[model samples]
Target: MGATGTMNDAWLTLREVRAGDRVAVLSPSWAAPAHYPQVHEQAMDRLRERLGLEPVEFPTTRRTTTPRERAADVNAAFADPSIRAILSTIGGDDQITMTPYLDARPVRADPKPFLGFSDNTNLLSWLAYHRVPAVHGGSTQISIGPGPAPHPLHLDSLRLALSGGDHVLEVPTQISEVGHRWDHPRALTDRPESYPAEPWSWAGPSRAVTGRLWGGCLEILSWVLAVGRFVRPVEEYQGGVLLLETSEELPSPHEVYRMLRLLGERGLLAAFDALVWGRPIVDDERMVPDPVVASRARAAYREQVLRAVAEYHEDMVVVQDVDCGHTLPQHLLPFGEQITVDGVNQRVTAHFRRAPRP
Candidate 1:
């Protein structure tokens, strides 16, 4: 299944953010806000103080919400003329069930920036299919909530995306893979310790590939694949940059390989021009608690994923250890927007908003 064409130019223009713009916050998946009101409120404060964006909560933004209720908030937010963007409280495990309740007409008629990752990937995929470009990284609880201030890179990428202009992003020089537990008192006042970043690893030819970017947590992607909900034809994804990352759940190398192989078998893996593999975390309390073991575990996860990808796409360009998913200093990237992967120079630049369509 060769790519049908390039989506790099197919960006769906959405409304721009301005001073006093209202952004809707919805818990489309988990009720993290409900369970962790302190963390949620702190994020809202940052939204107002940091970005000057007013945070508006939906009926289901907090409280033990149902899938239908969550979907309603999403539809309602997009329908509201005042809402400039939609942000998720955090990622959960069962967003696949909420999609059926979503009405695409409002979102399509008035597309706005939708920001999240992991389980929120379901919503991002739906928006992409409707030609609504969405930010595929960032979350209220993690990237925006826990830190004393948002990571500089995350703040910079988000500002550019909301500013409604084209911007080039460089990889973060530092990242924090560890953080205080959400329940810990320091979660609000403290910031995580940071470590120097390893340069992104590039595989395949020393060439460049540019296209619209898609994909999220690999585990949720498997769910999307099995459910056959938003998994479009391989042709629809031709020449797109596939973004994949793991979660704190920390799946084994075998599991990673299995999922990648499944995608390859379906011809999905071959549809993308390149892959941006997020840095895998190995600090799960239950899995690799020892920092030394964690590093080894992450390396094994990378090896397994690369092996599976190579089996299907020998010439496909791949960039590993990108500070995008389940890691600190995450960059909020737009799905279905143009991105250039300079395999030759080991650079990846995502065009948040494309040039005027000819």
Candidate 2:
């Protein structure tokens, strides 16, 4: 495996998947599949019926195991030639713990597309640090299983990630931050209620900026930065487009600002020419139950994010409230591939081709 920051020109090769290609579905973080077998099964069924791909599960896919054990499953998945791609059952809090146990040899030897977000950001960052490209969002448990069917926007992006192509992202008119309880029988048949989605907010210059994509769930990224193993030299991120989103955990806007402030202090903030902020889940409806409060919280998050960015580079291109991350109808981003953030035209284009080697 190449040293951190040394393999800037080479990115993981992403092969287009055929209809019957086998995809490893692993729970590298929490075993949500074990807890909600019904939901997991439905997600698997959709993976077959909707995507026409076979879902392969490892011994630990539905079981909560030690970090090393989880790493072993990830390693086995990557080393298996039959597995064309890897998908997470869901994201959890401790994926960062499993990172050190992952062996880079298989990942470097056979780089396949891995789709996940939230806590899965740990693995995504690990892959990026090792020069292995993957997708930023696609939780089988969240995106596929919970609702009546997969979100159209998510399905489109997942197809693009698996089949390989350039796609301009579509913004959904309605979005949902919370879904029905997994244990509820209605979760399988009913669609979660959604509200009118705010149009994506763009700031800075009107010109377009294009670069390779980086960043993920802000909380998980804080853990990644603290561990310092997955991060390359700050210069390695120069000109890359930063992708950021908060999870359903709904950290305060101050917390969001602090995380970005830390990135600025580390010189990581200024390295990116553009930043794409995923639509944030302001408050859990179950907890707050007030749309007005959720609306205000969302605004504060946007304010803090912009304040942090202004502190470092006020002219940096910033696009917020994108339909990615914790929000329902999420779009998967090509983690280590090129993306064009067109502020002038207000569009985001993702390039899905295998990155060239130097």
The top-ranked prediction according to lDDT is 2
Residue-level lDDT of model 1, residues 206-275, one tens digit each, is: 8899888888889998888788766667878888889999988878889889989998999878998899
Q: For every model shown, what is its TM-score relative to the native structure?
A: 0.93, 0.96
- Alpha-carbon runs more than 4 Å astray in model 2: 1-8, 287-290, 354-358
The candidate 1 region of ten consecutive residues with least summed lDDT is 1-10
**Inter-residue clash pairs, candidate 2:** none
The lDDT of each candidate is 0.81, 0.88
User: C-alpha displacement of 87 in model 1, angstroms?
Assistant: 0.5
- How well is each residue in 1-358 modelled by candidate 2, as lDDT tens digits? 4454532477767777778889999999999989999999999999999999999999999888999999999999999989989999889898888888899998888788999999999999999988888999898998899868988888999998888898899889888878888999978988788777778889998989989899999998999999999888888898889999998888889989999999999998899999999989876666223667667777898899999999998888999989888878888899988899999999999988753322
The TM-score of predicted model 2 comes to 0.96
The root-mean-square deviation over C-alpha atoms between each candidate and the true structure, in angstroms, is 3.1, 2.4
- After aligning candidate 1 to the native by TM-score, how far in Å is the CA of 90 from where it should be? 0.1
Q: Roughly what TM-score does model 1 have, to 2 decimal places? A: 0.93
